[model samples]
Target: MGVHSVNWEPFLTCAVTGAGDTLSKHPDLPVTPEQIATAAIEAAEAGAAIVHIHVREPATGKGCREVAYYREVVERIRDSGVEVLINLTTGMGGDVVVGDRGGEDTPAPGSDFVGAMERLVHVEQLRPDLCSLDCGSLNFDDDRLVYVMPPAYLRPSAARIRELGVKPEMEVFDLGHVAFASRLVAEGLVEPPALFQLCLGISYGAPSTPAAMVAMRDHLPEGAVWSAFGLGRMEMPMVAQAMLLGGNLRVGLEDNLWLRRGVLASNADLVRRAKAIVEDLGGRLASPKEAADRLGLPPA
Candidate 1:
């Protein structure tokens, strides 16, 4: 892979809430569509050009693939007239857990596996400015659990995402994931100037280190627009590393719960910190209009 230069003018993507079980860890973690929408607005007001979103089961706080929840969140954000670009997640419905016993029951519970088209249902309906396309799957946080997305599923999903006229932000967890995403782009399933998100520091994946970030960035397709994020304490450090490496960066409660050692952070708080870091480093934050034009999305 060739060395890719740094992005002097970078965009910030605040992932308000992810599918993880961070509710108990952070008291203010957004659960319902209303709260999630509110968090997105706050992040936007705090200088995030894009908001990466994942809906949860309102009553349980666990991530869900319900279109109603997504519709509510999208409607709320649009109604609020936030200038930030919306990037809905299609990373749900791919989690799988295995049982000790074999056969049909061996699949075990906590598995939300579904076909490719089923995962993109929400993206097709709302047709937001951007929707994430997890390029590959890997063993989740636990041993028995795995996120499954083979080429069979991704190819069709990418094709459908292209058809919807919504830009696909290819989320890559590791090096292999980046290679696979590049293949999709090579095959024309994804359009030019492909957007990528390097997810690091998750259990069983790439660590949140300069080497890992650079390796992933180096391997990205030529001329690809990309960003990087690390989980937990590494979140803030990765913010600097990503920018230094010439890429945009993401920071939010979804990837981290604390702004410091003990204090919890709101989505806006994280965005504010990231903005400050970018400015201090002599890098400018791109506005939503600037980001949209660079990423080839229609104006909001």
Candidate 2:
């Protein structure tokens, strides 16, 4: 035989800008609605099956809970004809921060505030095909963000997501989160062929290593549609790792800052790089429609 090639087609998602430490870190992090939409549309054109988004105020670059911001971003994306699955993050309200001594008495500023329904309100209104529902809570990084998702909270969040006809893309940060997600499926809260995002390399949670990815992948619900991401340097490596383990991949300025060392990156650039890696490994890129079908979402 002269030449034969293996075909491995995996969907790619571009997480535009995450809701963490981006304020002072990157000068070009998309903060305005126009910026977010432009970046997302460009990423779609660059071969992102999905555009995972988190909205921040243009003036402050700080994470905002205003539903209007989400509305503007979603509307812009829809009008732009990018043909990419929209995956807005519902992982916002789950943040919990405890106060200093005797501070439990005093509610920590902006900690553990919004309820489950409130968290999914934007998703309900915007009706993005998919939204991230963080499976559980964990101690976040030096940012001192305490990510908290109690069962009491997640149950309602899942129910709300179902009611709105929006898919809950369960975010599994650790092994326990995987178990919790399965329980949600068992409880009939989350629908069949559950969608999941295996978040790795974030501090104090699962390490971004092959062993960790395998463990989490094995624990996921059978036939579950899943994507994986590694933060910082391991972000792109985990894309290939997730593919080897038979899963999809996600990348963007959210998880990583550089196209290479000392060079700032863009959402489109991340997707382009991810495309090259997947293709080099003999994996084909999935289109937005294909990705939507794979994840049981309404096609773009």
Q: lDDT winner among the candidates?
A: 1
Model 2 misplacement above 4 A: 1-7, 102-106, 110-112
Model 1 stretches with alpha carbons more than 4 Å out: 1-4
- lDDT of candidate 2 at residue 9, scale 0 to 100: 83
Candidate-wise lDDT, in order:
0.92, 0.86
- The residue-by-residue lDDT of candidate 2 on 1-300, one tens digit each, is 122223278888899988886769889999998899999999999999888889897788977667898899999999986698898998777776666754654346766557778888788878898899998889886645688789999998899888888888899899999999999998999997798899999888899999998889888776677889999889889988888888889999999988999998999999999899998897789998888777677678
Q: How close is each model in CA RMSD to the real structure?
A: 1.2, 3.7
For residues 1-300, could you state the per-residue lDDT of candidate 1 as single tens digits? 555556778999999999998898987899999999999999999999999999999889999999999999999999998898999999999998887875667578888989999999998889999999998889987678889999999999999999999999999999999999999999999998899999999898899999999889989888898899999999999999998888888999899999888899999999999999989888889999999998999876
Q: Least accurate stretch of 10 residues (summed lDDT) in model 1? A: 1-10
**How do the predictions measure up, each by TM-score?**
0.97, 0.94
TM-score, cand. 1: 0.97
- Please give the lDDT score for candidate 1: 0.92
- Candidate 1: give the clashing pairs: 6-246, 7-246
* Residue 195 in model 1: lDDT: 93
